[model samples]
Target chain A: MTNTLTDYISGYMDTINQQLEQFVYSLQVPERLRDSMLYSIQAGGKRIRPILLLMACEAYGGSPNRALPVGCAVEMVHTYSLIHDDLPAMDNDDVRRGMPTNHKKFDDATAILAGDGLLTASFFAITNHDLLQDEEKVYLSRELSKASGAEGMVAGQMLDMEAENQELTVEKLEQIHKHKTGELLRFSAVAGAYIGGANQSQLQSIEKYARHLGLLFQVQDDILDIIGDEEEMGKPVGSDETNQKSTYPQLLGLQGAIDKRDYYANQAKEALKEAGVDSTLLEEFIDYIQHRKK
Target chain B: MTNTLTDYISGYMDTINQQLEQFVYSLQVPERLRDSMLYSIQAGGKRIRPILLLMACEAYGGSPNRALPVGCAVEMVHTYSLIHDDLPAMDNDDVRRGMPTNHKKFDDATAILAGDGLLTASFFAITNHDLLQDEEKVYLSRELSKASGAEGMVAGQMLDMEAENQELTVEKLEQIHKHKTGELLRFSAVAGAYIGGANQSQLQSIEKYARHLGLLFQVQDDILDIIGDEEEMGKPVGSDETNQKSTYPQLLGLQGAIDKRDYYANQAKEALKEAGVDSTLLEEFIDYIQHRKK
Candidate 1:
């Protein structure tokens, strides 16, 4: 199942990359703005969000191809958030995925517009998706908006920024992660399920699984920041500490954070089992999240 | 007709403002972020976009109440653009509508997130609008995404930024205004028509009227920057000159700019006439655009 999942994801990554490239190039935008947008997207990451969307769809007996455009839209949203998060006014990061951040490679104005362009384009992608019914498109877009909007990811970002350099409780940290990272990931999982026409019970099960998976992903990220190798992480360790950001490891301690990750991973697996769907690929993803170096 | 239109608009403004206030307060966002967003919305502008949307719908025999959510949504998009455009990296304006800009009132990070929150919330508003059919909602959302996305407003903004301090042709300036301001306004007009089930020709006519109206608004803004009162305009005059922005007055002189404004205003009236819909209020709007001091 692990090998099969890996093979499936590798192929899906190629498809997603191609779709994204085509979408960006298809835009009749100013050359520099287009280049700036493509630059960040082309600076690849793990492509985890799109992969989860596609895998969830496949698990529910839907064709991955049918869900490809939606998967690509989620990736675009994720990419836009990362671009904005790296802006000078935000995280001020100089590098992303080992390359210069968008604002670093391009001017700050161009980077900001690039983020705007990508975010706007995500909605356009969904509205123009060829296969989905209009009703389905509406549902998918609404879910995406809710996940990305103020009460969700953006709120979390605000909370995270406000929490910076301050001691945070476990509840505050959970709130931040849930909004900042968890909502979008949960949306990705449920969006695929929605596209696949999963039954209500299946939908709820996958959503629960995704919630745990999202927490696990963030916890492991905290652990990696403390203990992971720079070569594998593609960024320096101790960034959270440098930024004075409260993280799972900061709140729970390194070993305690590891325990939290393990706990969520187990919960995720259990939810997948209870979903009563094909769980092999999702289970493999859970394992990957638990063990990934970066 | 002018009296009737004025009364109608005043009433609509109250309703729209109330809806906007209620909508922002309904969100469970952090206090600072919510305050930042609400501050700009509450600061008050002409509310031109939402007015156009509601009026167009009313002209097409649709219930204004049915289009109220969409009107508010367009206003949110407009507000978000203003917030982002005022960022230090962009226009860097300290004041808007006689109030400190969002970034000045709140921090830069809060302003950016607030703008993002508003933009994302606009989509959520459309999807959550209960009165419209799902298909209508999809169409409205698609039209909005196109207007606000890369090929439209954001593209225009990039071009405008890139063209700063450079000599620009009248044609180039037209391109910039069309994308930067015209697209969203055009969307506002046609969106209402779409919701009202306007025929294809009506849609085209409203789109044309909106294009001219959009250009007229920008031209008048330029003229105001040159010759209008600082008190009424709510900011200092000649800021366009100060910023080295190529405005109508800069490119074509003050009288030339006024002539241009009249030309578009007349064109807008002509398009409205040709549309064969009730044009009383829309005509008044055109006149308002042409002759307003601010």
Candidate 2:
């Protein structure tokens, strides 16, 4: 690895994967369910959600160890959502990150239970973390639940499904992605700030930064689905078109979508600057989001 | 409606139902998902889990209002489990409470998301409750997550699915029921005690009482599946036999199962008596478990 942002991300990914493995293995579930869950958690991703959490915590002067459990919890939530979204009744995808989707590797029943198990375990992970105070634990758990529950990610999915093949304005598209992808990302950033004892103004600034970054992430994903390589992206391109789901490029056109992504990225940087915290890593993260091919 | 235990239960049931209605309605989910979720929750069961929680709280001299949120939270968990269990990949039941199951009424995808929504909302309900201290909220959320997660109900369902069509020993059958049904019941009973400020010995006694009661409840369910009226039960009898599920009545003879039910009911009463708490409503609950037609 070179001394680039990619190298830094690679290091964080290694640590996050190790922590996730230990956490899932330590659960007292049956062997089959445990194996099924471990399969997906170990199936790799960028580990963006958790890494952002740790970086935010450190930038706000909290030890990364104190926020590590919350990071794992958010990752579990993300993994479980992916497992369910790829189910036959949902998006019906057969592959994720170049590996078979959970329902494909395990049966549908096991996959569903695995998702449920991970979702449930996320709360346990939050509450059982030893380093955080009880107050922080309660607040984080509540926020995570709200982000994941009917009002947030689940509702976003419902709307996305309902909006399939329908003409959508950019506003409606933003609403869908904001709830589906933004809420948990927002929670990740804000929770770390809370744990680090960030002031009210710092918390608000970090939340704004996360909101813009989340939108930028989704818009970039929309652009990638149209133009990215199949092998690098680890799945077929044009899935959004196949699903007839609304996308940023679909609403704003290709050039327009690129401009939107850049706009959000700049807004995110501005928020970070306004927050006036250590921004070296977060700035790198924003740049990575801007230029990643996959 | 008299001052008898039956009337008291009826009152509690009404209050719980209303609270559940208000909570689901207040959620910011899309209208369709909200309706689907409300449909399942409004489809009535005995509300045994939430009722047990409230009764235990009152027994420990805590006002039931203080524990109402936890009651609703447990009920949401139970409702979500039922929704998932009725999926085509799982139990595949089409009818529940004399109406279409969640998946049958809605689509499979909607049902899955609805279940996920409720499960996520459950933790939110626990932590967002205003009356409890942060410590109690954390403890209760952790307990609920453990009871509902892989090590508990989800694991039991997996074991049950795997055990189908295979002859299960009495020991294995006990293990399945203990995780599948007993853990949530145990949490309900013990959480109330904790919130109501029970002493250590009192908590133990209630936990023991709840364990016996949980097993007794399952044994009776198995017996009812054989002999109870479908109209009263609101679903077909003999589902266990149809599914090739091992039940107490299958592992032990009918008479033996009945004897086991009586034994556990008596043991529950004994534990309650030893605890030296108000036993009027709890004793009635045990009797109800023994003799209810549904």
Candidate 3:
């Protein structure tokens, strides 16, 4: 299952990079600004968000290749968020994915504009797409905005920032992750399902599946922050604890948090079954996330 | 001409404010984040861009009220730019429209999220419109993203940032304003005419009118920064000079810049006539921007 999923992702990785590169470079913006944006896009993210979008679309009987641009658009949104979050005014991280952060490599001003450029370009990738129908563009734009905007990821971030130094209940932490991280994952699956023309029942089930997967992703992140390798993880660990930010392990004991990650995994499996998504690729994702080393 | 336009603007001001207020408060975002967003929205900048949109729509026989939500959406985008520009990494301004800048009123983290929230919400405002068709939404979204995104306003800001302490020719200065300030203004007119169902020729003419009007607006802004009263302008004058930022007034003589503003105003009027837009309100906008105190 893992090999099947890896092959699927590897097959599309080149296409994804090419399309994103061509798109960003094709823009008529100033050279320096364009370079900053391109730099972040070329940075080594796991590419999990976009790969999930393609797999979901494939599961819904849509050609995954056709969904490439949309997947790249999601990656842009993801990249933009990371760029903004790493700003000195925000999380202030100097490293990302083992390389200098956007603000570190480029100046903060350029990083800010680069983030802005990527964000605005995400919508352009959709609305100006030659292959997508206007209705699809409309629906995708609406969903993307809702998921990424104040109503979703941004709201969740605000909640997380405020949660620092204060004790948050497990339920409160879940709520934050559901909005901050979950919405985009939800968007990935839902968007893929939508682009593939899934029925309402299937869309609902995929939503459930993605929601669980999102929490699973966050829990693993908290766990890794405590126990992961510094070289493989690309940055120092325990920064969250240093910041005194509450996490699943802090609220739930380490064992309890591990138990919770398993519970969400089971829920996700159940939802996937209910949705009739029998793709080995998606199943591989579940297994991969649970046991991922980095 | 002035009174008619003033009446037209006053008639719609309350509606615009109410709609923005209602839409923002109704969001399920965190309270502090919501308050930060609302603070900037409620900040007292003249609603010139939105009013221009409504007037353009009305000139084409569409009801001004029908265009109000879209206008508010543009306002959100405008407000977001101001917020981001005022960030310490950007313009580092402390005051905007007689009050603390968004980063000044709230912390930088809150300010960044607030800007992101507003930027995302602006799209939702258009895509979720009760009165718009999917095709209309699609076209509007494409234009809005291009106008506000990297291809337009963001690119312009980057150009301006790079221009600091660099000698800029008149052509270079116009190029920056065209993207920075001009793109959104261009969107306002083009979107209004589009919503009003103007012919292709009419839309093109509106685009031309808007292009000139945009440059005219910037030239006046530059002139005001030099000669305008401080209290009325709500900030210190000569800040542009203090920054050593190039402007039309600096590149051209003060009187030369004023003359150039008048030239664009006349060009705007000619395009308006060609578009067959007979609105006294739009004509008055040309006069208003030319002599605006702020």
Question: B269, model 3: CA deviation in Å?
Answer: 1.0
Q: Show model 2 residue runs off by greater than 4 Å.
A: A1-4, B1-3
In order, the interface RMSDs are 0.8, 0.6, 0.8
Candidate 3 on A126-234: residue-level lDDT in tens?
A: 9888888988999999999999999999989899889889999999999999998999999999999888889899999999999999999999999998888989989
Measured with DockQ on alpha carbons, how good is candidate 3?
A: 0.86
Off by over 4 Å in 1: none
C-alpha TM-scores of all predictions: 0.99, 0.98, 0.98
Tens-digit lDDT string for candidate 1 (B53-128): 9989989999888899999999999999999999999989899999999999998889888988898899889988
Best-fitting candidate, measured by lDDT? 2
A66-170 per-residue lDDT for model 2 (tens digits):
998999999999999999899999989899999999999998999999999999999999999999899999999999999988998899889988888899999
The reply for model 3, stretches above 4 Å from the true place, is none
Over B133-156, each residue of candidate 3 has an lDDT whose tens digit, in order, gives: 889898888899899988899999
Whole-model Cα lDDT of every candidate shown, in order: 0.90, 0.91, 0.90
Rank candidates, TM-score, best first: 1, 3, 2
